[model samples]
Target: MDPTLFSSIDFYQLAKREKNAQKRIRLLALAHVKEGKPRDEIAESLKVSRSSVNNWVRRFRCDGLEGIGNKQRSGRPVYLQPQQEELLRNFIESHKLSSDLPPLKGKDIHAFLKHYFDIDYDISHVYRLLKKLKITL
Candidate 1:
């Protein structure tokens, strides 16, 4: 597990633009590891946990160049399909056009998704999904 394996054009570009101290330190640790420095030496020089060094090395092994970058994973992916998303959007749009529905509420949409999709997601997640769909509410 050497940083040489992680070094690529994209990795250099990321290293140049990267500003966070923790991320920079992580990258530097990988660089040292690629240069054949022992983990204990790298940890001492970077003033970080040896475990952190091992974790980043493992990530490099698994993801290659992109592994050095932070990933956006949080929870499991939502099970909804694209059609389901479209259906939700159509439902919201129809409600808006007819004015038959009450004012849009986060709780309202959450309940709707629960009943129709049988999946529970937070109102905040719904809000972000709506924003991504360019739906203003």
Candidate 2:
């Protein structure tokens, strides 16, 4: 097992020095991998796959810094009905609720919209919709 450092800094320093989140994470993971960290440790530390470590190393070797960033993810388009999603946004803006409760969870808001506006939504879908609106949870 090699103990070479992949970048100028240690893993922690590489993580802090890199600007892009994905790139920083990958560099830190690469530093760990080069230091011969266990696959599970690398995966858990980086929240990526053991296979992803292999993939990252390949990308690093092939493309250098450019490939350390996120790849575009491909999947079925996830959607929330635009009109209903907007309605939820508007309702939250309009209504000021005071309760001995945490800020309304997405599920609670989803249920509220469904019950009052006859809008159907999965709770997770509501979270995605909120993200599109750039509303922080």
Per-residue lDDT of model 1, residues 64-121, tens digit only: 7567677677897666799998998998888888766677788888898999999788
Count of clashes, each model: 1, 0
Candidate 2: give the clashing pairs: none
RMSD of each: 4.8, 9.2
Tens digits of per-residue lDDT for model 2, 2-74: 2232444365776787788878878888788767788788988778888988888888777765667787889
Q: Each model's TM-score, in the order given? A: 0.62, 0.42
lDDT of 2: 0.72
Clashing residue pairs, candidate 1? 3-34
Best by the TM-score measure: 1
Report the poorest 10 consecutive residues by lDDT, candidate 2.
1-10
lDDT of 1 at 17: 72
Model 1 segments beyond 4 Å from truth?
1-23, 30-38, 51-75
